[model samples]
Target: MPASLSVETAAPLASAADRLRQIAASTVRPDLLGRIDAASRTLADATVRVVVVGQFKQGKSSLVNALVAADVCPVDDIVATAVPTEVRWGQQVSAALVTTLTEDARTIRTPIAPDQLRRLVTERSGAPGAIGTLHAEVTLPRAALAGGLVLVDTPGVGRGNARAATNLTLLPDADAIVMVSDATQELTDPELRFLQQAAALCGRVTFVLSKHDLQHQWRSIHDADREHLADADVDARIIPTSAFLHSVALRDQTPGSRERSGIDQLAAHLQGPVRADVVTQRQLAAAEEIVAVGRLLAMVAQSELDVLLDPASGGVVVHDLERAQKTAEQLTQRSARWQQTLADGVEELIADVDFDLRDRLRKVGREAERLIDSSDPGRSWEQIGAWLADSVTQAVSDNFVWAHERSLHLAGVVADHFSLDGRAALPELSLAGTDQALRAVGGLDFIGSGRLGIGKKLMIGLKGSYGGVLMFGLMTSLAGMALVNPLSLAAGLVVGTFAYRQDAQTRLDGRRAEAKAAVRRLIDEAIFQVGKEARDRSISSKRVLREHFVGVGESFKQSLAESVRLAKRGADMPKPERQLRVERLTADLAELRALCEQAASFSTAHASVALRSAS
Candidate 1:
């Protein structure tokens, strides 16, 4: 996207497909051409989402605007982004507001004036059309976005903030992440932790230090930041930039200023590693499909050509293909090794994930009990309740992250037995949006003020002691003794003291019991809600793998059967006509082999070369 890096850097992917399409058209089978066209469309429509996240007022929006060289995202002095703003490619500058009445409701996209973005995206009360606003979106005709690179500007993140959780949700869908921080200081603990998380979720995380022009000591800060990253074990490239300079460069049309702004270099990384990686992945996937089709067609042509050249050997050729067809058929069976592995893996995952959730909750429950013991639940319930909620939320989040990752590992295991490439397109498991599942756990119903008060305790004590005094006084008077005797008076005093102690102890024990029960109930509900969510996601992933691998097996079986049919048909031809057919078959086989080689080349070597060249 920089002036130095030509737009032609993005052209290789399209060019490769064009060359392949020409060859595919020459093939006799209609399905071959259709497959290549569909792949090309998928590649063309693919968008690389680069999510930008950072602490509040770190110039995140400014970095986004500078990267695209457009005032798409609104910048502010005091307030920060409240909702995500997605800036992507369009023929003309346009903005839209995405809204929904509730989390589960369908989204509505309404067009808005470009200038209205600031009011909608920033923290503003009573702004028109701001109610139920989910996120803001803008599109421009900037060349930086021409290759389907989308820039997401997210709300600032802080420790334990829901905004941070929201940012985590974005990482699963992001192709790359840019973490913005100003050069006023080195990395903070929270920022380091966030970087580690972003790296795990999306490996293409780049650290960008904004406001470089304002910090005279930025180089020292950069050095310290690198060391902090090394100590934290977060892998990211740190780039320093001055968004102010970039804005000035654009206004003055000065390339030198733009280069000094460091925006150009950052843009190059996106255009190079970030955009190029997306292209490479799509290209490899398309190549895999092409090669598979080519191999099948070549098999049919080669078999038919064998029969045409040697008419007497037609029977043997058909027999060999029939044998191969049976082998392919076995792959489609329920008893296949891959199918068995998938079933076992899913079962193991369900049990393990449930246990993991319970273990995490058990630890949280113990910690809650400790807090309750340290202070009276009646007075400190507010603080304790907040702590409990945050702790449980964290445990649930960590458990889900583990489940999602394990599911991916299981998919790779199945791919080993199913695919010749020994790889799988990472299954699109719906791992994000756990807010609903988390809410399903409900809240604890512990009445912290449930214990008896002083007035009630006094009343209960009097009632019990009064009965004891009346019975003892009557007994003493029946013995012709005055009720005011020392024996009677002593007995009355002891009963009253005993009654008061018993009542107080009972109330205190009951409150503790009630609090413990509530804690247990909360933990149980969390286990049920989050555990069920994990299992559902696991089932969805299993179904995807089952459908994909079974389809591949079926294709193989069909191709082999077609090869057998072609061989038999060629054998029945007259000798004179067979001679003419052999020549055409031979040429087609050679062409198919050549195409397979080209596809293989694209799948393996071209991607890394593109990265290096773009750099």
Candidate 2:
């Protein structure tokens, strides 16, 4: 179904290390391969087989059917061949086709046509302009047993719609590729671009310019396509002929065409022994993927096993379960600033309003009754108190709306400038911070909501002694029924406004500090992981590459020494020495003769082995 599943259960017919072992077994050049793989494996996936791809009208289905002598992919639709498809084999067994992708698949079914395929691709993949999917097996006793030479028929590269692009990204897992451009139009820009880029994946490439029957008279078209490929240094076959034309003409009636069955010859070449080595290497690589995946699974978390097996950043470790407690603590500490900033913003609202509601209310209460001097002083005061209460209520309602609006305006202003990393996001924080700000201005009501009594509210919220802080709101009320002369409500308003400003400023500062600390902690952890991984991968890649090179060097040394020894001649010999005057000369001659032959063979095998291993 998924590639992840393929990797997990594959049992990697070979491990990464086993790929080396397999190479040692499969090498045609034992001297070179043994040197290459003895110390460690490298290049296990040695072949790059390419699937010739394009739109329905682009001759993809035709080309593949012709090559394999079987109709492998469906070719009957004008508009809908979009879903991703796969075709795997099980030797010459002729097992049924199995189509799969994210649980939408058909098993034991024949291939589907392009129009039918459109439904599968669009409805299932959620990709635009999708065609139905097809995944069939072409198992002939002769086919699967052909090592690993698989030539797939893919949807168009650039011609397919967006839906096509999403599903068809997987077609080029080939040892080499042969891009088929229609011979009539020749090498169009779209066709040329796809070929140029696909070549990077596998250097082995050939260009097939099909549709030659219509353009046979136009020899210039064939010459042009050939020249383009050659100029790009693309060592690919540029064949200009139609599969249908070739197939039909080869029938008994077309005498001269009988000699040239284009499709038949292409199949024979692809099925030859030349492909054996490439197929073996691909098999080895597939085996290696299976083994490596298995080894890592035992250690991953059961819930996260799929993620670890996933191909994209699969090995990345985010938060481990063990870190939950510490991470929670960090989050809790971090959120305090959010609450604090809002409260600070509320204080700012109160300060910037200019008219403190409490003080203004107090002035209204006193001014309305300041004209009263009663014959019954106490009773007169009672009458004045009733009138003042009404006056204060009316004045507070009317005047305070402006103050409230000012507060709302200031909150929005500050919030608009907030950022998460630089400053808090003002719009969101201002919205979220509203409740905290209201509690700050709500006098006794605000204190009760926070699990703090009026006394504690004064202490924590006012940041002052209980008596002085508690007197601010309560004093305004007392001044309206004064035992003394009227109080300075404006002065009190100014003082209270300052307190609100200070609180807003303090909260903003705290929030900024908290957010910065969070970023710093995250960055520090990332840096540590990067450093550890850098050191580890560096050591691993180097160890793997070095041992491989050393083994190659040792093999080279042995080869060179062996060559020297073989060059030595038994037919020729050095002159013999005499005695007396030649006594000294005779002694030297004996020593020289003894070493000459040995020098030619001295540890040459071991030397070559050492040279390859080191090199």
The parts of candidate 1 lying over 4 Å away from their true place are 1-34, 42-46, 55-57, 69-71, 74-82, 98-108, 115-135, 158-166, 182-190, 211-221, 242-261, 371-390, 419-430, 442-522, 603-615
TM-score of every model?
0.76, 0.36
TM-score of candidate 1 to 2 decimals: 0.76
Q: For candidate 2, write residues 1-615 as lDDT tens digits.
A: 112322332232323334433432432335534433422332343233546654346676677656655555566546434443334344433433343332233334655443444344323334332123334344444453254456665555442132233212342245556576665676765555555555644455656666666665546887887787777666666555467755676444574563343555555455442254344433334333222222211112121322223323222322232243233233224243433444465455444332354455446534532333212222243343344433432333233334334443544543332221121111111101011111122211010111226674354444432333345546655756432223434444454556655664565444434333432342233223322322332333333333332333333333323222211211121223112313432343343333322222223433454466458
Weakest 10 consecutive residues, lDDT, candidate 2?
Answer: 428-437
Candidate 2 stretches greater than 4 Å from native: 1-49, 84-148, 166-168, 249-261, 272-615
Clashes of 2: 43
Alpha-carbon deviation at 604 in model 1, angstroms: 4.7
Candidate 1: give its CA RMSD in angstroms. 6.6
Q: Against the true structure, whose lDDT is highest? A: 1
